[model samples]
Target: MGLALKPTDTLIVIDLQNDFCPGGALAVNDGDTIVPLVNRLQQQFRHVVLTQDWHPAGHISFASAHPDKQPFELIQLGYGPQVLWPDHCVQASTGAAFHPGLETTRAELMVRKGYNPQVDSYSAFLDNDHATPTGLAGALRERGLGRLFFCGLAYDYCVFYSAVDAVAQGFEAYVIEDACRAIDLHGSKAAAKQTMVELGVHLISSDDLL
Candidate 1:
């Protein structure tokens, strides 16, 4: 059965940035392939929000910031375990910009995350510490947008976390699976989907909406 998008429902395009695409510093395999579908999906929603992974140079999530560390290694932080990543998406850099082919004109709001050098932000609603609010929740609430549909980037990380956070923030969350790609490090994609499903996130596909 097809899902009809309500006017009050919001579509969140997560981290469709240069760094997460092909030829980027930290590219997800075939990440660029989803851009056209995402562009099409956005048109079905009356409200659209775009998120960017706007990190600063030497951000805490980068392996380069930690001596002798390499990308994908896990380390414990004040909040919990953290995954260090390759240097990417620095502020004011090409990698931080939206994917060149992504349609942004339909987006009513843009949320930039991971700018805080002390923490890494995967969820569009909250930083990884699970304390700091990125203000996305409040913004959506104020606009009366309660149901959130998420897509874009690595399905195992940002997209997964965002959908989880959306449910936690009192919004109905759905993941359009076919509209996303995944890094899938060590079965992380499978792990993320299970967690999201357990947490009340609806895992659907682009065909469900379009």
Candidate 2:
């Protein structure tokens, strides 16, 4: 059965950049594997939005910014627990560029996040502070898009958070399982799934959508 897409549905592709793919500074396992599926999926959606990590050099989220910290280490920031990542998507750097393999031309809007040196942004809707809106919600609302279908890199982080925030913003959200890869650090993937269930975000696979 083919998945029926409504006129109000929008596909949000999160952080499908080079730095999150194979051989990336902080690679997620099999991250590149989703590119083909995402490319195909884009053809099925009328409205598509892509997100870029787009961090600046020496961004506060980088573990290298803190002398004593190492990548993947958790540090307490004013907003909450911040994951110290390796310097990956530095702005204007090749690593920060979208994967050449991705079909980005079909996307209607491209939202750049995590640009502020003082804050880390995982969800495309808002910065980690949860106060600064990324204008994504407003864009969707303006377009009258209500149901958000998400797919892209790092299911446990960006994709997960984006889906949660979508619901919080009064949109029906769904995550395409096979089209996302996860860092899964210390059971984060499992925890994210549980949280999504509680928040009423639907977890589905591309097969279900097909």
TM-score for all models, in order of appearance? 0.98, 0.98
Clashing pairs in 1: none
* C-alpha lDDT (0 to 100) for residue 167 of candidate 2: 95
lDDT tens digits by residue: candidate 1, 64-158: 99998999999998889999999999999999999999999999899999999999999999999999999999988988899999999889999
Q: List lDDT for all candidates, in order.
A: 0.93, 0.94
RMSD per prediction, one decimal? Answer: 0.7, 1.0
Model 1, position 166: C-alpha lDDT score: 90
For candidate 2, the 10 contiguous residues with the lowest summed lDDT are 1-10
Give one digit per residue, the lDDT tens place, for model 2 in 109-188: 99999999999999999999999999999999997999999999899999999999999999999999999999999999
lDDT score at residue 49, model 2, on the 0-100 scale: 96
Superposition error at 28 for model 1 (Å):
0.3
Candidate 2 Cα errors over 4 Å, as ranges: none
- lDDT of model 2 at position 100: 91
TM-score of model number 2: 0.98
